[model samples]
Target: MAEVFIGSEEVAAGRVTRHELRRWYAPVYRGVYARKDIELSLRDRAIAAWLASGRKGVVAGVAASGLHGAPWVDPDVPIELVGVRIRPQHGLVPRADRIASDEITRVGGLPVTSRVRTAFDMGRHLERTDALVRLDALMWNQKFNRADVRALGDRYPRAAGLRRLLELLPLVDGGADSPRESRIRLWLLDAGLPQPETQIPVLATSTRPVAWLDMGWRDYKVAVEYDGDHHRKDRKQYVKDIARLRMLEALGWIVIRVIAEDKPSDVIARVEEALIRRGCSVEVDDLHRFARTFAA
Candidate 1:
């Protein structure tokens, strides 16, 4: 009763009187209602959008990614649907795009775009950084074939962001654990640094891995890690991190730790210096050019 529902269906089913519905429910979209006091999650909004579309549209884009258990999705992002043309609303974006039968799947009883289709739509719709961030999260949560996404691109060559999608496809790495990590990775690449490997394992034994480096060049034994507030705020993690840093240093690994307050340029500079110290040649002028243009 508290969940999102079609207003007419609930009233006609005799579950609630019209008066009660008017008193206790709030409109989420035309004809879609949820309890007035309930705060809508992304899933709730997706469901509302679907109900508003009379169950004809498949939820797609970031909302579909979220429903597929991908982390880091902004709950406030508009719910997107394909195959229906419901009027634009605050929380719902309806697309009249055609969807293949195989491209749709059910998530929690609601139709949603399949993982690859969701990835394809995201790459074709979102801006570059945001698309990569969500794609990284989605891929990290659920492994999908990059070829499948590319195939969809081949099918929809005339799609709006196809060029951008092609440009971004090579850059996605599921090993990125957070949006910040993805951002830093992009910045390093944009700055003309060699593409660093991700999730490099520090082996304690042939079969046993002691720890994983967030990202870096293994040949140089240099790594860069982004430390969110949790790394510092959690006392146990803080203590373990200090010990871990010592161990890595002993193993001749230079780890450049990044925190929230560090400027992107400064972090990149530190990484460049570390790489240089480790005998990895980099163009100084190129790094400076990137520093001058680095945004976010």
Candidate 2:
């Protein structure tokens, strides 16, 4: 919609008074105002805040995550700004950390942290599973990979969370389609299961593609699929899922379905059993490596 501006700008335009500023423009920040009719998106809010900061704010944290095209971040999450020393205020997370010029970029003319830096910061600030979720989405959306993260870490050797980034780097995979998919993949990895290839193609007798497994071990013809809410709520999607699973089973594949309600340990159990049934071995100790993550 319309570009939001500071009260001084509207006053300079000579089209509005304080009464109009109060009535027609909604306060996004103390002095920044957006037209009342316009719905503010995260970007709009970020821009409003930057304007409120006298155009000196550089977006960071989860706010920057959204700017980089990663989804599932809370919309109500505070807009984070970093430029100079500042204190947190309503609807804003401010920091005075050193940010290189190259670390800044723009989306729709609003300043934001670069994708690699955004992800690197997220890895430090967010929980491990949450960070992986954002990282997976970032990779899928931006075509970025682990190398970028490594390079950023190298550039900022003394930066916080380098160890966390290194720990998460091995877990990051672009093939995950949703946060749940990313979590499932990580759970399996933490349990010491064989790394499953994502979005694996199931070939027909003619060697043509029939379906793609969400995650699979080709040797065992086992697939793990995470069904989101849409799968159950949409009738057409339900029917297609039935047909697809039947086709997969007909091809001598074992399909394991995981849902949001499934407990992490139970999920590991089911998949572990399936792998064993297919004549594959699993390390017993590996199952407990990630046990502490679920203790809470």
Candidate 3:
């Protein structure tokens, strides 16, 4: 309930004092500040905590993921929030969403805007790749469900960035930590190919789960994995890689290994070739249209 001061004309009905402002509040960035904390919060966390300090912290990106009940951030990722000053030491990410704070309202009792608004905010601040990663991870890994995010579109009818993020959501591949996977996924989407599944679990009646795949079409028995060259240079790891590939091949699984140079076109062609080889007639045309016609 305590409030950190922004600025005011009267500390005591007279001229402002620089000494007093520094004494009363620790400055954070231009107009922001921590009430009395000595350390400076990161650009992002300071802004988030500042807003969350009763000013309505509009959660987006990883912060929104946490609020939605699934926090999908790298271990090293700081705890980014908007609004408020008080925070734990060394690992918080706060940033200012300097839009009209008045229009923002709490969603799901968390200080975030409605899902649509949150998504909109995310598109603005986060890089497109970062946005896609969180979107894919949240929808697939966290199972937060896209319907919840979509449902808010009506409420935030004019939300700024929703349209773009929605367009790119399906293009986001699951289980991607690196930028290469991100690029591959986007390329597939652009080529109008079915987005490949990320980290799909494979289980058989006769055995326990032997492997979880990076990208695959389980129904078609087609698996596509990006094999960056870094894994094989050492003789020790190279031998192990060959054994794994041979075992997977013996299991009637089609494995396509590829690398960075194939960017854009190769991923699309490879997935298409695999599906066709497996007797699945689905063209790249009908891939992402799965949810378009059906209304849930």
lDDT of 2 by residue, 71-105 (tens): 77676678888775555679987766678889899
Pairs of colliding residues, candidate 2: none
Best candidate, TM-score: 1
The Cα error of candidate 3 at residue 151, in Å, is 1.6
Error of 2 at 52 (Å): 2.5
Write model 3 residue lDDT over 45-138, tens digit each, in one string.
4343544344544555566554554344543345555554444344545555443465355544445544444455565457776777666655
lDDT of 3 at 83: 52
Ranking by lDDT: 1, 2, 3
Model 1 lDDT per residue over 40-149, tens place: 89888898898889888899999999999999887778999998877888888887677899999998788999999999999888988899998999989988888999
**CA lDDT of every candidate:** 0.89, 0.83, 0.56
lDDT-superior candidate, 2 or 3: 2
- Reference-based TM-score, model 1: 0.93
Q: Best to worst by TM-score, what's the order?
A: 1, 2, 3
lDDT, model 2, position 49: 75
Better of 1 and 2 by TM-score: 1
